[model samples]
Target: MMDMQTQPVRSQSRPVVEHGFVTESMTDTCAIVANLEHCTNTAVALQSHYAQGFLSSRHKHGRGQISYCQSGMMLVMTDEGTIIVPPGHFIWIPPNMYHQAQAQDGMCMLSIYVENGLWPDLPGNSEVFHASDLFECLMQRMIEIEEKGAFSSSTFDAIVTLIRDEIGLASRLDMSMPMPRDRRLARICNAILREPTVLRGKDELARIGNVSHRTMTRLFQTELKMTYSEWCQQALILNALARLAAGDPVTTVAMDLGYVSPSAFSAMFRRRVGCSPKEFAKQY
Candidate 1:
């Protein structure tokens, strides 16, 4: 039996607060999140730093959140999919959505929490978007205000409005990978995620899932609405994004992902990501 459980396990530790910001070093983050959700402020901003390989236990917040990755990459995993937030990008998580986060190569992030019903158009689903220069500046201002405890400042209100408008107009990135519900298919997906460079054959993957090739194909298409090969290609692209953002050399990342040559990998990355690996790395 595969015995692979795909669902996120909830943490039972009590929550703790420290330094006016929630720190993973304290305790379970649930308590701080709960307190923030009920704060009277229209929006609250907090900064957090995580070391490489840091993973937060599965949790949810009552307020919608905008998480901006300032210096590294983050992977926000929800039941629907896993969204990659590289530097210069942010992910908006809807209120009360269950999710877990992982730091890729360590990260410095700023999280903005908006009270419920503040923006009627706030998306009900999580989305990743490239942060514009102006948006980035506005977020910095918000952080300054947060540090000063100036929620009632007229300047704070003005910046919040601009931030909301920016978010509404920002370009969304297709960086998420939808997960399958079936345990057999989930097992195959997990294996690919663990070692994306392997390039396993379809029959081999099917065997690993304890299914025939055709059944495996159908499961992917039916559950994820994407063909198995297409899904794998996306998986590879996401992995490449994280690696490149982590300051990995283009050639090194290419070789690690099993590409025959840097040129070949660069070509595919350009086609899917709309930029060469070198260009993408430079942006970070």
Candidate 2:
């Protein structure tokens, strides 16, 4: 029988910070912090205070990555929109495509970069998924191996296989932000995303997009099937979800997003997400 005392416990907190953003020709931040040539599909790295957003690299490797913010958060903003990664949550960024990440707060990040081709059927793009209890345990165990330099043994191989299998069968990644395909509308969408909680008026955003307020409203309706206000509300909801995942108190997030009171925020979240912020926090 597996000994409970020997089991790895999920870390309760982390200290990672946000990275800014990167372009297509750039390399991953992993290469800068760790020895990439020595990095392996089975090897993993644990880091704290990861505060910079790495640029997007279009490189597609057979290697897949599992990144966890045990305490802080990461925003995996891809061409496909963003995936908010908070403590107890991990993001799977498949090989290739343009992808980048930003941390919301200080972070304790453990990255398991893999090469088993195990997650082919998963989303063709980046996604955030809740890490299972076993998967979280496996991640911590891998960190142990790294700290102890145990990668030379077959024990490490066993761990790798286990992780790959978990990825294959782990729950489907349920959280994602699908990108709008239209170039004109996508520009406006991206602007909102950069500063979701900010009270930037539509007329201001319209000017940023080099279009009139009327034109912007029409594009959102005719092309995206949502009104300008509706799209903005969705952006705020998504932003709130990220903030909540980062362990921010409901009162704080509500106020930061310009809500006058916690009850108002609760009402908005309930209306959009079908649950209160407290309930949503409990689910993750």
Per-model TM-score on C-alpha atoms: 0.85, 0.65
CA lDDT, every model vs. true structure: 0.77, 0.62
Candidate 1, 1-105: lDDT as tens digits: 012233223344443332233333323456667768656777777667666666677899778899888877878889998877878889999888999887776
- Cα RMSD for candidate 1? 4.4
> What lDDT does model 2 reach?
0.62
Q: Residue-pair clashes per candidate, as listed?
A: 0, 16
lDDT (tens digit, per residue) of candidate 2 on 1-284: 01112211223342221211111112244443334334443444444344333322333444566777676656666776656665667888776545666655445666665544555665666766666788778877866655555455467677767876777765544455555777777787887877887788777888887888888888887776667777777777777876786568999999988889999999988765556899767744
Q: Which stretches of candidate 2 lie over 4 Å from their true place?
A: 1-49, 52-61, 151-153, 168-187, 194-207, 212-230, 241-249, 255-284
Which candidate should be chosen as best, given TM-score against the real structure?
1
